[model samples]
Target chain A: MPREITAFSNPLVKRVQALREKRHRREEGLFLAEGLRILTEARETGRVPRFLFFAAASAAHPLVRALVHAVEAAGGEAVETTPAILSKLSGKDNPQAVVGVFDQFETRLDQLDRGAASIFLVAERLRDPGNLGTILRTGDAVGAGGLILVGDCVDPFSVEAVRASMGALFTVPIVRTGWEEFLAWLRGGPGQLVGLSLQTEHDYRAVAYAAPTFLLTGNEAQGLPDDYEAACDLLVKLPMLGKADSLNAAVATAVMAYEVLARHR
Target chain B: MPREITAFSNPLVKRVQALREKRHRREEGLFLAEGLRILTEARETGRVPRFLFFAAASAAHPLVRALVHAVEAAGGEAVETTPAILSKLSGKDNPQAVVGVFDQFETRLDQLDRGAASIFLVAERLRDPGNLGTILRTGDAVGAGGLILVGDCVDPFSVEAVRASMGALFTVPIVRTGWEEFLAWLRGGPGQLVGLSLQTEHDYRAVAYAAPTFLLTGNEAQGLPDDYEAACDLLVKLPMLGKADSLNAAVATAVMAYEVLARHR
Candidate 1:
């Protein structure tokens, strides 16, 4: 039987709750993964969490039992907690059955086997966590190399972004680098820099995204900085037919990613 | 000078806030529109809001003044309120410069000129307000005739849905109906119904969407019901290359909508 830790005031409970903040997540090099599916994926990916907590309501669930056993076998702590504790950690009235506390797993652009992969989505200074997350999901759908976050993009580990990713964050390798470094790498890197912007002449579909392609997107508000356009081997735009000034950043990225990768698939 | 309704407790303000709820919106046949941009689009589309409220911070903004004049000229009320009041109405601490209260504008599928539209998206029992809103925005981006909500879908007029639409609610016509009525209308209608599901053997892109094309999608969780698949003139599925069980409903719709419409545009 897993040990019971029912108190909502438990110090461990507080620590899990604190992981919701970027600062705490950074300081601890840890983040929380909610729901059985995400935790299951985490386990299957060999990224088993250090801590596993489950609500009393889910104590008897077969999958919960299996997950708890999996955690314990992997030298992780699996503790049964009160629903109140789980709800507090999740910020939801009706929380999921299980949660996992995992170490932040990331790789740098320089660390990757660059030549092995061709397609990539480069996002610059994306502010919205949801958009970034959805883009991560889209990236996975197209089997892109990885997502390279340039400049000051929102933390992919942020709760909103992770939740929005719908488990793709676990699959997608996120590379964080500064503008100058990323730009320099792209220039020397083995791929085309296809910048998407409203100021471009070519229709997004009209462009040939022949693999070994790096599809670049920018911030939600101001879009790609003016000089950044110079770095692009090609620039393309999604048509704005109606009164809408822009497509949601995630939607635009998904459309572009699919156009680039889907046909070939 | 526009009237200064300084009191947050005012009955008018109370009613406007209540419009956030589906029951209240249904009862009053009214809904709220936030931000200067959406209101401006509403005005340009000739769908003038009945009530306009501006934060005093925007008193000097030229566009705000023009919008206020436009509202009042159309026999609508335009009032100035404090930032605190605007915040209360918007549920955002830093609310936009202006908000508008508009009458519900909707129609039935039968009322639409079916022959006029080549591309259409019919969503069945979509539960997410944000997904519904994004689909509406995508529908407008492709200039689809309208969105046909089959069965009990989320209210597109809800505050969250409208907010997510990013002003497309003004430009896109929304039609709500039950399954039977929608099916009957589709049978008599000119467009071909293309159902999207995981069960289908056909790849979504393989089939040419001969217009008038009705791209039908379903709920986030369960997807389109089995019987519904029988109704589709053609059934296709987006490639599921990764571990994700499904793509976000809105993303799927956008991918399909753009494929069917963008090439034509």
Candidate 2:
């Protein structure tokens, strides 16, 4: 049954809004992604939106209408409401015309390595949701095997991460893992491990980046830990010139990923 | 004398909040930059704050007090407000402990030339403020001669840009110029011109960045303009192997900037 949720006080709306908080998202195993582009990409990937909301006034736009129709066609609920109500649900002062609450993807690390040479991303303690999402998009662009979320990193499925990913979230495979297990896996790996660290004296360009390399990065404020430094066969530092001392984690990861791609090509 | 702004409803507060809007920032030729780090960096460079605001309660942090004291010592009026009021006036949802307003610097094109050979960044219609700010920091790090803002671009002093730049705004000389003049300047060339484009068939490493070069770039969404391609003495492309078309503008710019620095050293 397609439910029409109108009130901002509605339970479904509450649940959707709750997904914005990290703890709530962790507890509920759900995340909300907004905007038409993300919704379209989600639909194309056979993702069934659990709940979809749109501004009734903007229901006339072809893109909006199409998104509503797609949601409906997928047997998901499509509800129309005032922009004011939508804005309230969306923590953002200016809400996108459309939003969707989608089920959290359950991906296993073991399942990701099935029948393929894997080139994965391991992010440790990344605090910024936007950086995580940007990395997801860049990973998708690079056709990475999957992403391994490690340490105290922000939830990859959070609203901010999803929005920043530009719909790449739906396409990219992500596996959240404990740091200890991640370290063990890297140590046990036949695959190459490339650790990105600002402290490393070695230049990034010096690394070969051959084989199925697991490109690892850490938090923006802090780079990878010393214990995990031994896990990598090579520790590479992005060439930097400023007093800021380092590039943003997402930017560094993207540059290294591109380098890997460049070498392989 | 510098003005001490205390009340949240003060016209100065309203103007500072309006800095979040691009239109307001451009129309007024002013922008707000927060945090002690940025304020201190600006002050160190002889930039006199037009106004300064700080938290009234919670004197636990020594750095906060030192920053406020520094501002007041420099003949700048420092107004203390409640944490709530400070948060409201800071523009960001979670405000930094301190906020300040400074006069918008008007940099002339001719001011870029300082003595002998020097590298400069020339950006055409760079839309993303975050990217522009990152580029500015990178330029400062490499000791670039200056920056030339070509074509229609975002104001470099916007709040987002300022935050991303990490106080590089006060140090870097910026010259905003038109396309025709930019082309003439590059072509007439006090030095060689190095252009970055995704479509360029030549590898970036192949280019000799020996001379005082104008490193030219375009927007994140689009590469350099087709007409300006001929004006560049050298066109170089970052090597890529991913499904993603190219690196983010800031990352790409940083890579090229560092590469030039490496070659120069």
Candidate 3:
């Protein structure tokens, strides 16, 4: 039987709650993935957490019961906890039956394989967490190699973003860097650096994306920095047939990513 | 000079607040559009509301000053009110400089022109307000004729959905009906009835959409009801390459919409 934790103030609970903060996540090198399906995805993707938790009342539920034993079998701690304790740690009025805590993972710019033979996404100064997460999901759906979070992009691991990603969070690798570093990484060696912009005269469909593609998208409000646009080998635009000037950032990125990847395939 | 509304409890304020609720919107036949760009789109698209309101301080802003004249010139009312009044009516701490309340426009299925010569979308039992709105935006981007809200979809005029739509609400025609009625309408007379489903073996791109297309999409979680799936003239699926079984509903719809429309154009 897994040990039951009733006290909300337990140190382990405090540590898990602290992981919600990005600074603490970075400092402790841990982040939380909640709900049963996502935790299962984490485990299946070989990104299982160091610790797992389940509400004591739900321990008998087949999936939770099975996951608990699996966690224990894999040398990770699995605890059964009271609803209040789980609620406090998960920051929900009613917490999920299960939660998993995994270490933050990233690939350094220098670590990217030059001839890896896969598409990658670069989001320039992206802000909306939902957009970032949807972009990640699109990247995964198209079998992109990874994502490069350029400049001050929103945190992809934020709860809202993770939920938007729908388990793609575990499957796709992400790299984060400032403008200078990203440009240097691009210059060194990779794939075709293409930018999607509204100001461009070229239609998106006109561009051939057969070469290993690095599809970069602009921020919602400001778009790609001028210097970064200069660095891109091609800049393309989606047609806007109506009064609205542009589609939502995530929608535009999805169109670009799917189109580019679809052509190459 | 437009009348000033300083008291939050004023009858007009109460009425405007009531518009936020679907029941009240249905009862009063009105909905709101906020923010500068969307309001501008509303004006340009000839969707200028019966009533437009501006915060008193911004009444002097060039765009607001111009819009005030344009509204009156176009036989509409424009009111200038205090910031608190605008904030309360708009339901935001920092509300947009202006807000417009327009009629809830819904065309009856029988009223649709028999050979209108345009594409249409059918969202079957979609629940997410954001997804519904994004679908509207995509529909507008592709010059779709209208949308059919079959079964129990979210209210398209709800604030969150309207924001997601990014002003496409004004340009697109919409019709609402029960599943049986929708089926009856689909069979009566329109165009090719195409359905998108993961269950289908056919790839979406391989299907030709050169004819007037009525694309039927399913709910985010449960997807199209099995009965509706049987009703589709043809079924196709988007390619999913990674572990995630599906893409966000709006993203998937956009991919399909762009692809079909691109082929025709």
Candidate 4:
């Protein structure tokens, strides 16, 4: 039997709602992920949420039951709540039937096995949570090892980013560090640092990407700094035949990632 | 001298603010675009706004002055307004210094010159305005002739879509029509209908793409319908190396567009 909470004023409901904010998530060391599919993905990835909240209507769902079982087995609480409370937790008029609170995965550059995958993605000062999530999905699609964030970036654990990732957040490892530290780690590893730059005349397709290629993209607006570009082992530019000077940050990263994937294949 | 509008209650301000809504934009046959760079792009592309609003503080900016000159030369109204009024109009706390009202471009499949560019993009039932705008930007970056929207789709003129396009909406010709109509029009021309499908065993890169390749993608959640996939001249699937079964609709389109571009180059 699961715990029941119907009131919006319930303490657990308030705690779960707070996970929507970055500061709250960081303080609690827990993040919210909604929908059965995402929670199933988390389970498949050997992650059990600390708390599982499901609407009473979804109690009979086999997937939901499986999730409830997993939560119980893991000594986590399973709560049966009203749709109104679920809506309050998700901040959406039409909320998912299920929402889960999971501990944040702390990833480090030193822990990453560069030899595990042929490609990796690095973003510098990425500000958009949606873009960060889209990049994570692209990383998953291309089978890249993980995504690395250098400098200030929007929280990957934000609800907006987690939603945008479409569950890639669980599948892809994310690392947050400074530029100097990231460069130092790359220097220590056997990886080709390729910077996507506008200054270079070298076409993105014209180059032969070496193994363990690390594709680096810059901020949505400012792009990579001069010294950062200078440190790259190679610089490439995507063709922009139209009047628009550049593609969206996430779109550019996807294009480059696919190009690298093709070469590796 | 430009007209001065410091009152938020002004009818003109209300009218401009109404453009943010899809129904109002359709009824008025107008749309809003913000930022000096985007407005300049519109001007360069030979499309002048019917009304240009600039903050009093930004009136002296060289770009703003140039825009004012262009609007005045074209018999368009240039209004000097307060930042608060601009914010009210744009619905952004930190609104751009300038915003413009322009007539929506009426585009049709018959008007598109498919031979003008070797690549084109088609999206089916794209629900997200942001994804629609990003696709337009991708179309511009790859020099696609245009983007064709099939079935019920979000308004390209929505402020969210327009902003996300980053002025690509001005450059890329967008056609909205039913799927059957689009197929009939596409079949009448010398082009290849290549769809991004999960059903296909053909790797996206393995195919020898013909000239005038029309890259088609499905909706964000459901993907392409069976009949739509069957109708394609060539069906291609992007590699999903990780657990994610699909990429973000816009990101997938960008990846495919770049591949077609590479082959054409």
Candidate 5:
């Protein structure tokens, strides 16, 4: 039996709660993974968890047991904690029964391409975590090349982002790069650059996506900056007939991703 | 001169803030509309605002003045409120400087079919306000017949819902009905029922979307309930090759809406 830690005042519990903040997560070189789905995805991605905590009562689920056994076999630590203790460590008002503390992995853009024509999502200064997470999930679903976070934006690995992703964080490769560096890399790189904007004269449906593409999208309120707009080989807009100036960032990205998929298929 | 109320304890200010909760909104028969874009859209839709509140600093914008003048012309009232009061009434910690209060209106589904094939959205128990609001905007944009809300879902006229709708609430017609009643109506009505689900056997691209159609979508967690599944005449699913089981409710709905537009065009 792995030792059970019941006290809320435990040092480990305090540390886990602190990891909810970006500063603390960076300092500790770790991030939190919630729910059975995220943990299973992380394990499958070969990202080992440093510690696994589960509610003693929830340890009976076959999948949970298998996950725990797998963690133990890999020389990682597993501990059973009471539901109360698990909630305290999670710092969430409604915490799931199982949580894992995993080491953070940095993803490089080159790692996302798998030899063929790849589709990469390049988000420029998107501030909403839910939007970014939904985009990431959509990217994962479409088997996109990877994600490049450009400009100052929300941290894609933040708690809200991770939760909204529905376990896509483990499956999609993501790289955060400055605007100058990213544009320079794209100009010299192996993909055709596609930009999404409301001011674009050409309809997205009209664009022919024949080559490996780098799709660039902007924030909901303010769109891409002028310099980045100038860098695109093509700027396309989703047809808008309603009162809204444009679709939400995530929806727009999905529409574009689906279009790319349709062309490829 | 519209009086400027500053105190957070002001009765009107407190009442406006309480509008954030459904019970309070019902008790007061009022909902909050923020941002200039939303207010402008509301006016364009012919819904007059009962009260228009704005920051003293922004009172100089030509569009802002036009909004104030339009409200007075329509036999309504306009007021200049302190930034602090605007913040309090806006519900958000940082509210848009301008906010408006309008009486909620109800529309019946039968009135929507006037010499044309109707195209509308049927939302079943959608809990997320953002999803519901986005769907309303999309529906209005596509010139849908009307929106029919079913099950015990979030009220479509809430503050968050209004914000998300981007002022489409003023233009779109909405009706609410019980689950069994809605399903029965779909069976008896003249329109064809189309549903978006991940579990469906066929891809969305495989379905033919004709007008006089009612698109039924469900809550984020579960797809449309089992009882209502058979009610739809056609079922469509977006292709998913990635790890995540689904797309965001609103995103998928938008995709489906666009597909309908494409088929009609």
Candidate 6:
């Protein structure tokens, strides 16, 4: 039987709600993942949430019951809550039926196996959480090794990014490090650095991409710094045949990822 | 000389601010496009704003001055305003220095010149304004003819969509119509409708795309309805090598657009 918590003032509710902020998430060493589908994805990936909050309305749902079992089996708590509390935890007007608080993954560059996949996505100073999440989803679709965040990028674990990733965050490995540190790691392995740049004459499709290719994208507003572009093994440009000079950062990454995937296949 | 207005309660200020809402935009037949770069892109595309609002600080900027001149030349008013008013109009705490209120394009399927471009994008029931905007940007990047909305979709003139479009909203022609109407229009012309669907065994890259290819994508969640998929001349699916079942609507469209572009080239 799950604990019934009807009060919004419940301590556990406050703790989970506090995870909405980055500082609180960091301090708590956990993050929130909302929706039954996302939570199910997490469970399938061998990640059991520390706390599972479900509205009484969805407690009978087979997926919800399965998730409750998984949480209980993992020695985690399954709390039966109200929709008001669910909405409060999710910070949405209409919250999903379920919300899960899972321990944050402490991913590092050293843990990544570069030879495991052909393509790796590297973002430099990617500020938008939505873009970061979208890139993660694209990374998953292309069977990339992982997403490496170089320079000051948005927190991959942010709720906005986590939501945008469509559960790709649970499946894809993410590495956060500075540019020099990331470059050193790449240099230690067999990888080709391909920067998507406007300055390059080579078309993205024209390039012969090597295995273990790292597709690097720059900040949304500022393209890669001049030095960053210079360091790339190959610099390629997507054709901008219309008045708009650039594609959205995440869209460009997806297009490049698919191209790289096609070439390798 | 540009007229000066500092009061947020000013009638013109309220009118422009109201454009942030869809109902008000439809009522006025005008929409807001913020930022100097976007406004410049609009001007370059031969679409001048009916009213240009600029901060006092940016009034002397070369691009802003050029915009002012263009607005005056086009018999439009350039109002010098406060940053607070700019923020209020844009609904951003730190709004861009410039904002433009422009007449929304009245695009129709009949107005499209199918022979003008080799690629066209069609989206059905796309509810997200950001995804809609990103699709426009991708369409522009691939040199597609335009984006045609099938069925009930988010307003293309929404400010969020315009911002996400990165000024591609001005360059790309947008048509709003229902599915039956769009199919009839396409059948009346020389075109191939290729839809992105998971049900297809065909790979997106494996297909030979004809000139005037119409790439159709479904809603963010529901995807292409069964009947809609049946209507496509060809159905192609992007490979999902990971656990995530699908890509973000806009990202998937971009990947598909580029693949079609590559084949035609």
- Candidate 3 TM-score over all chains jointly: 0.91
Measured with C-alpha atoms, the lDDT of residue B87 in candidate 5 is: 77
RMSD for each of the candidates: 1.7, 4.2, 2.8, 1.3, 2.5, 1.3
Deviation from native of the Cα of residue B210 in model 1, angstroms: 1.4
Error of 4 at B140 (Å): 0.6
Q: What local lDDT does model 1 show for residue A179?
A: 83
Score each candidate by Cα lDDT.
0.85, 0.75, 0.82, 0.93, 0.80, 0.93
What CAPRI grade goes to candidate 1? medium
Docking class of 6: high
Backbone clashes in candidate 3 total 0
Better of 2 and 4 by TM-score: 4
lDDT tens digits, residues B83-185, model 3?
7878887888989999888877778988766466457888988898988888889888888878889988899999888988988888787889888887787
Docking class of 2: acceptable
Top-down DockQ ranking: 4, 6, 3, 1, 5, 2
Assess candidate 4 and give its TM-score to the true structure.
0.98
Candidate 4 C-alpha lDDT tens digits along B39-94: 99999999889999999999889999999999999999999999998898788999
Off by over 4 Å in 1: B262-265
Question: Better model by TM-score, 3 or 6?
Answer: 6
lDDT of 6: 0.93
Per-model TM-score of chain B: 0.96, 0.89, 0.91, 0.98, 0.92, 0.98
Clashing pairs in 3: none
Please write out the lDDT profile of model 6 over residues A1-265, one tens digit for every residue: 7899999889999989999999999898999999988899989999999999999999999999999999999999999999999999998999999999999995799999988999999999999999999999999889989999998888888999999999999999999899999999899979999999999799998879999999999999998999999899999999989987889999999999999998999
Query: Which ten-residue region of model 5 chain A has the weakest summed lDDT?
Result: A109-118
Top of the candidates by DockQ:
4
lDDT of 1 at B73: 93
